[model samples]
Target chain A: MPAGKFTQDELDQIYAFAVDLGRKAGDLLMERVEQRIDGSDAPQTFEEKENAVDIVTQTDEDVEVFIRDAIHTKYPTHKFLGEESYAKGESREYLLDAQPTWCIDPLDGTVNYTHLFPMYCVSIGFVVDNLPVIGVIYAPFQNQLFSACNGRGAWLNEKRRLPLIRNPIPPMPANAPSQCIFSCEWGKDRRDIPDGNMHRKIESFVNMAAEIGGREGKGGMVHGIRSLGSATLDLAYTAMGSFDIWWEGGCWEWDVAAGIAILLEAGGLITSANPPDDFDTASIPDVKLGSRLYLAIRPAGPSATESGRESQERTVREVWRRVRQLSYSRPGA
Target chain B: MPAGKFTQDELDQIYAFAVDLGRKAGDLLMERVEQRIDGSDAPQTFEEKENAVDIVTQTDEDVEVFIRDAIHTKYPTHKFLGEESYAKGESREYLLDAQPTWCIDPLDGTVNYTHLFPMYCVSIGFVVDNLPVIGVIYAPFQNQLFSACNGRGAWLNEKRRLPLIRNPIPPMPANAPSQCIFSCEWGKDRRDIPDGNMHRKIESFVNMAAEIGGREGKGGMVHGIRSLGSATLDLAYTAMGSFDIWWEGGCWEWDVAAGIAILLEAGGLITSANPPDDFDTASIPDVKLGSRLYLAIRPAGPSATESGRESQERTVREVWRRVRQLSYSRPGA
Candidate 1:
């Protein structure tokens, strides 16, 4: 397939548009929160998506519609894929192709938003030829904005270049888990089926958090375990090098498409969250937006003995060895 | 024993001094982080506290000394209890007494600070009559300041009143766990002994996170579980009503003293993290500053049939029924 092409001017225009739209959407989110806090807005009403814990509020729907309308008005020819629209069955088929497409998660941490937890964001990504190339994410609660494109390095609020460590990014630790601050999610999948996603996720969390020598050598004894309840923020934090690793499963392309672009631009690595059947001969697998599983590591400093990529790969492989094999797929796939 | 008495003017002066000191300490923390990020500061050096996962840095000790010196110069007669002093054996005996005492954790979330994860803060707490009477917590990274004194309501940044809900705080849900956002910690303890702190903590996390109606009804199915790696911030957020419930074990008095003061002033409730042997007859136990285990809930709005305290207690009792009884004591206690 031919790669979708865009001139330098066009790419710059798209990036600017995404950033402007993200900030505007973030403003709308802030307005809603403030209104609710002051009792100006009525109590929020929500509907369950997959179960009781997986929810969708009217603001999510409103924000998606707002973004879609603005995008359609500005770039009438561009195709768009958004979480709320997809959930509503407006897009019945997978939309990726060798074309320019906009993927968006209007409110990435809806649960956090509903609970006023201050970690939610507005994520917007531009994809080209099935690759995430241009990304913009705005977390209004923190007033943080992350943006990146294919070749240009990522930035925080359009000023500070990421991995945020202007110094040489430190190399991954020799014993990865013992020295790594890892982030993961207990996603919507809550089933207890043996070896299923939830069961595997719980087992993986315990293994990573257990003593270094206990649990029959499966203990990761990581520096810390954090669950921010938002994959977008988790990936963004990883891109900025605050979190050294992020492993996630059972989320949609819109949930991570933008974060993946920023992370890669920050010189990070992305691979399948699941390990290979045999590590002796297999290289780490690449992660696609639709894979529904991913493992991300921050940019590593190059050492005399190993290149940055080599160190990252070694760390990924070590982590893979300690975690359970996880499986997840899109609904009805 | 007589209660330590303070004139209203004295209390007001103390509160102002604490807030000023906290901000100054926070500024120092921010300066250090920026220096390290810009490669202008020397690489951080740390000493392991309990094990590899628990660490202390020069900044923690430096900040503590700075605060202690300032307190001594201004209030020479007042006693002081701080994390670094106790760790260094400066004050050998337990100092909680009916005296005007200042308890401080110079840099809470030291691990996150070292990693530049941006959840750290300076915590200054004042105790009188063996009670946390005035509290000030400053998170410079986010520029959030939480302060409170007895009688006067809590404030965020000295402007917004907390729970931050001016109208009325929402009542606890009837089925508590299913609607609560819980904050917990995977602390320095990593022992996997049967029913040990680590063992019980992991089990409780899994139980609360599992699907409802799973594992023979032990599944709590809470809305979300967040581990911020900072008990001080956890308690502060709880005081602000951002987190509905925070259950913590194996933390220090300096870690929670200030936060406890703010939480109580915000109309929240604090109790033991452990459940009693007989729920039918036992009342929820009160949590002391050095209890090492605590369960806190947000301020509940009164309902037709139940007052705010009753609602909070009911919710606490329900959560207690779902979690395992955890035991933790200070090392060599």
Candidate 2:
């Protein structure tokens, strides 16, 4: 299938369909949450896979199946890729060259779900030619629904625009103390890595982000650091400008697919963990497939005389450069 | 100024006064927030004491003074130790001599305040002989107010008892995956500590926390980690059972004072980061004033077949031991 540019009418149809699907998925999860709370129904339990905490509940499987079935029924020609089904050899490579494919994580934060924390959400994205064209993420518990279509703007609950604050209080002056927030998973492969490389990487990043001015005036002391557990929520919140910047590693594509689209639609910037301009479509597919890291920054005001967009891009690149220069060693290495 | 217990009537009066004070403080904050959001007012500007991110806004000082004045007007003889005024020599040590005292962090998360992140709160605690006898914490933006009196239980919005699960889930099993969530701050004294130590400590903790079962056995994965940016909210969430555990270093007593009271009243446990214990007045006052590490855990079911208070205490101790054994470094040390 060709990478067709969506007409206004096509965009409208897609928006309605995406919203309906998002709400449907959200309603199902909410029902399950209430049932879990009431103790009237037990979530279908599954064998402990990677770890007990990593158990795949029947709800995850059922939810993915429900989404996939509904999408197939509505748009029989569209391809689908979902987290749970992907684990069963359902395929990871997207047909970017085909009609828009749906990439979904039926439940973006299963651990939070099992533990009953209210940070989990349902994330869905539409990709065409390996680029996110439409995205919808819903957190039923918080009653937050964020969606965006390519070239159009993003919205939260269909009213508020992305970057909840239209004009953020101006950016802190250069050399002013800044704060950086990072979202990361402890990850399922903790024991396999040597020298604790992942841990070292995070610590190094935090240290750099939180560094105060030194004797030679080097480090810019950051105000604070936060890790709120859910990448989808973190990304969305970052897009909303609640956080100045977000750096994340070891997350899957489904983890951020919808969030990336939303973030971009909100005038946010995301780059490969490596560096700016190193970002491209090939990298985009892997980013969605969960093989890469991301740095997302809410748009910032221009540097005195610079344009706002240029200033933001430069700031993001500078932050990324600082991150990459730091070397990390895995545990036991 | 004696170490005498309050009569039920006195307790009732104190509780009523605290609730009123909390609501009034919350109202002031909400008003400011609304003004800032509506563009009617500008972000509070102040001198940078430690760094630009470490702002000393006028609102913080004004709020602290208001709380102190209200308390003084009602209880003229009571001592007050507040974050903003303690530098004038009104320290926690004075409160430890068996006198009635109030501990207040007028704005617990000032950075969140500057960013309008909606997680900041007003933390207040009334102590007798340096023991937190009554506690109140209010997050105006979220409209969440948590309060507790020693031996009287805890409440959210004066209606919900903590660990707010309508259906109580059983305590995580011993063999349950070691999924612990931790909270830490990028404190002001980063330069005093070696970057290597910071890297090693964080690496060790995250590594241990992330490790799924290894040679240690099954169900030993560290479930996940979170750093929500506020000590008060972290403790409150822990008491609510939304978070399994919280550990922090470098925060003053004002940061954890009210939270400590609420957590204890809700059947949770608090101990020095160095060791587990039944925290009491002697330890709390000094700890509140000085920078020390703390760990708080929600109520968990006793180990299988463990009966009696002694057994429960043992189980709690074992859990604490297991948790502390997972390493996190002290920055300077």
- Top candidate by TM-score: 1
Tens-digit lDDT track of model 1 for B105-207: 9999887887788789999999997688899999898888999988777999998888866576877777777778889988888876778888788778777
Docking quality of model 2: it rates as acceptable
In candidate 1, list every pair of residues with a backbone clash.
none
Worst 10 residues of 2 chain A by lDDT: A324-333
lDDT of 1 by residue, A153-210 (tens): 8999999899877587888877787778989988877765667788788778878888
- Per-residue lDDT for B256-283 in model 2, tens only? 8788878777877676554435422123
Candidate 1 DockQ, CA atoms: 0.69
Task: Provide the fnat value for model 2, as a fraction from 0 to 1.
Answer: 0.54
What DockQ does each candidate score versus the true complex, computed on alpha carbons? 0.69, 0.41
Give the TM-scores of the predictions, in the order they appear: 0.96, 0.83
Q: How far is candidate 2 from the true structure (C-alpha RMSD, Å)?
A: 5.7
Candidate 2's displacement at residue B274, Å, is 1.3
lDDT of 2 by residue, A1-333 (tens): 212666767766876898889999989998987786566776334556655446577888889999999899988988887878876663444333446788888987777776666678899988776667678999886678889887778887888776655545355246432554443444444554444545445544554544554423335456666666678888887776677677666566777878888887787777655443552222322233343467677755555676656555555655554453222222211
